[model samples]
Target chain A: MPVAKILRLPLRLAVHACSGLVEPLRALARHRSLFLLLLRRDLADRTSGTVLGFSWLLVQPALQMLAFWFLLELVLQVRFPGRIGFLDYFLVGMLPWLLISEAVMRSTAVLNDLSSLYSRMAFPIVLLPLLPLVMAGAIFGMVYIVLVGLLAGPLAALYAPLIIAALLLWLLPLAYLLSVVGLFVRDFRQFLPFVLTMFMYLTPFLYMPQMLPEAMQPFMVLNPLADILAVVHHLILGLPVTAGNWIRPWLLWLVLLGPAWVIFYRAQPHMREAL
Target chain B: MSVIALRGVGKTYVHYEHVLDRLREVVTGRRCHREHVALHPLDLAVEAGEVVGVVGLNGAGKSTLLKLLANTLQPSMGRLEVRGRVSALLELGAGFHPEMSGRDNVYLSGAVMGLTREQVDALYDSIVDFAGIADFMGEPVKNYSSGMFVRLAFSVATCVTPDVLIVDEALSVGDGIFARKSFDRIMQFKQAGKTIFFCSHSLYQVEALCDRAVWIHEGRVREDGPASVVVAAYNGFLGTPGGAGAIVPADAGAGAAAVTHADPVAADGAVQPAPGAITARLLKVEVEVDGVVGRRLQLTTHRSNLAVRIRFVSDAASPVPTVAVALTGTDGRMITSAGSLNDQRQLLRDTNGVTEVTLSFPRLALLKGRYAVNIYLLCERGIHCYEEAAQIAEIEVSQEGLEQGVVSLPHEWAGSVES
Candidate 1:
């Protein structure tokens, strides 16, 4: 009897953890209208009082891309191994990076910012982390359309949607994990921007992977973000892709997502008291 | 079937001295914070088509129970089941964006209340008309007055009627006219056979609207029964001397007699006496019918005598101590007063010991309604009240004659209107 009870405990925990993944997806699908409304409200609120409304979304990434373009390509004279121009590489890499960083960074304070909504209303709490993810996706989609039109041809632009899906798939779980952690840890928000800056340097945003030293080149594969950016660069700029390039980033994302999804699902019920 | 059911539901909040302490507690799995049981485990059930009112003092866990039922707060222990879609109006204008116009906010607020865009579109004009802010719909909500903001929020919230509605004092918004309209709309919801969980300090509304009432005290359910019974018990508890030391007296001696003060009255038409703190403390205030102590004194038009007994303990010797009792009408007007100084009686000193005073009224002449008695221990000439209890005891009058105003006057109709 004791052995059976002990064995059942593990099975029960496994079932509960799996349900954590399924419950949020079910809630999101059921409350899709509310999710869309929140997405719309967040977008409208961001640009409500500004002189230039939706254009500010485009202006920000445009300005960042130009600054990096000048510093890395023009001033430092960095070059890729292939005929890929530095601007195309930077644009493709920077856009998804912005989407990922903004999603993670904004999610760090999303729970606190919407604490009143959680405490006062009857809406599903799982959808809150998705708000920033969807908002960042919308911003990325707009910027991606413009950059593809200007830099890449219309045929190459067709790959933008698939890239977005990949970026969202990677960022969503991270958003959920960080949002739950942020509710408990107050220092995460204060320390996030610095960590993101360090992470950007660690990734191949400003330069290509081959630009690094021979010893450091192989280590770039450990950063899933670098792998994702390399995949985007190859897809958008028609650069050659290595065999392991596609498998490594996806494997890393799956590895991160399983724990993240379980932690987020387990943390959802306790968030009400924590807040 | 019960629409809302809870079994041994409890919510305990861990309070940390600092935010870092919370993070440390979570990380190290060590107890670093104090736990506050916001609500103790209890059981309750509300069947469908029933409107239940939750009455309690400010920190009595009424709002906590409502939030738990609304699913905003997860109970730390116990099982709670709320069937069907539950829409809560916990705070008015909670999700309204100030930068958005009223038109846009109506849609956003509707969606927050679980209404779809098509639903909001269908009820758009009706919401605007119900809010009575048609012209201001184009302007930003920030520009709207607080009343207008509440009106729009309330309109949008009620437009989408759910199976269960939970409101926490949101109907006390807007002017009296709009409040009445909002209340009428709530009644319409009740007529449509929806379950409502309402929390308010207004016992009169609870008595009038709810089928049952629950009184929460210090995070526990103290009493729960039919609306009238629970409200009466709550009023008796409030009126009982030394029960609630924190109830502030209604500052009624501001010389504004015409103002309609909204004091909470129980179902039996007896106001909850304002419990005040004074230099001398009132020990007990009791009513008697023919010298038998009772909760209520039943009186007829021209028969039956009523007596009120007031007991107090003074701290120091008061020179020329006088006891006064004034009957205030439902509108907060002083209908009549009897004081030792006004009667030109001899002054009494050395009022340190506990003393009891009894005032009797032969043939109670007031009309059929609730009336409050304001008691005071004053110095000579009624200059200052050394001890005061405003609206301390209530005297309910039942008159057989048809008299509309405060008191009845003997008369006969001689003239008649001719067409």
Candidate 2:
């Protein structure tokens, strides 16, 4: 009986995790075309009035990366002390960082930004948080795959998609959590960009984790984003990585999945009234 | 089977001092907000193929109830069941995106309504033809005029008919031609045996379109019955004198002799407030026909004299109050009304501030129908009413021959038309 009871614990946790993941995916499937239509609308709204319309989706990100490369390589003369080229290393780390920051930043305001689409009507509101994820995934997925194909070979470029899929799954809980928090606590949205900027400086995107002072190196393990980038470099570049790097972020993700979903579910009734 | 059922369904809106208090209350499990009951718990059942109209004053929970049925709002407590594909035309542009082109929006709105791409393709041309904006379908909706915008939205919403349609006063959607078109579409839905829940202030339209009505007052069902009866009761309530803070005392008729110098007292004794300072109210209203003094009378068409004797009291300071008498059908339609002011007559009160006037229609020409008498005490101009006694008497007229409508207009066979 005790052995059976112990076996049921992992079974329960597995079911809990699957439910948290499956419920949203089911809702998305029911509203699959609507999700796509709204995703297109969201993508268009960002570049609607500009003279350079849909092309800006690609040009804007490319221009931003160019500026970062100019400042870090040409002006600051920062070099990576490794066999891997500095530009390849920076591109591999920076593109995924861009995808994460853009999706996370937009998740904070996604509900409020598209509230009119669902507020006064009967609509599936669960699809709203997924919009920013799919949008950022599409744009950065193409850019990352193309760049990786150029630097590391065609076979290695295929890993870019797997990398993006993992990041989206990891971001699922955070997106739902931030969407609810962002609407209820408006001040969180106001200073969120600053927080994202601070997060970027802490993550090893601009500088490798080794370059940080010896004392601060131990603390890098505390940032899940650091764990995420470490795994990505291991998978793509064959860099050395520990099992903790693999286990830490997924462990945190598992911890947050159920709570984030529960909070969002409880807050559904208040969403319309909050606006 | 009941298509819509609500058991103890209610909504109470909780207002927090700050938005954060909502969070605090949720986190702490303590009361931190005040509540306003938008709707009280009540049970209602709407059967299939019944057209029910909702009538109420502003902010009387009509919209809340409709939202509950439309699934836009969750009730605070109770079970609400609406069975069928319920389509709500609450706001025409609810799911419309301003940046999307009209063509794209049609598909988008179809998706929002749970239609597939194939379904939207089938309805696309019809929607475009109905909106009459085919040339501009490629333009972004933000560039469309308000009329064009609403017309397109209306076309999209009604293109596919649902089993039950809930309309919140969107009948008059655009310009005159388009309004007629939209009204025709709703009429078609009604003719197709679709159950409809309509809320509107247009009483005439409600009486014409709905078979039953529900009157919501202060978050409760005040009256619910046949459309004409509920509308008549609501009309009488609207015409009640004290609704607008008139100065007539509640017992004005009981103590008429002792009530003297009953003027609205001015702030300063030296200055007399000239306008509406005098208090006026009805003292007695008597309906007499064929030498019988009673509330309900039987009369012969064009042979009975309908006489109404009105006695009222007015202070000496202001103008004498006008007296008006109206005969109406039992459905609250005014057949005819006669006022002393319209005839340019001046009235005088006795020394005790009481005035009596009698209006007699000798040989009344009213045809065979049940009619009601309503008396009003009006201002000198006959515009503002000081007091009213609605449905004071009932007159049932019998005729020798068949004559339709409420009145018998004077006629004599037209003196042999060329045949």
Clashing residue pairs found in predicted model 1: none
Q: What's model 2's lDDT at B160?
A: 94
Kindly list the per-residue Cα lDDT of model 2 for residues A137-211, writing each as its tens digit.
Answer: 998988889888987889989999999989998999899999999988899998998988988899886777788
Q: Candidate 2, residues B28-67: lDDT per residue as tens digits?
A: 9999999999999989999988999998777889999999
Model 2: runs farther than 4 Å from truth? Answer: A1-14, B27-29, B241-419
Cand. 2 TM to true fold: 0.75
What is the DockQ (computed on Cα atoms) for candidate 2? 0.57
TM-score of 1: 0.74
lDDT of 1: 0.74
Model 1 per-residue lDDT tens digits across residues B79-103: 9999998877777777787777899
TM of each candidate vs. truth: 0.74, 0.75
lDDT of 2 at B81: 94
User: Where does model 1 exceed 4 Å of error?
Assistant: A1-28, A73-82, B23-30, B170-172, B240-242, B249-419
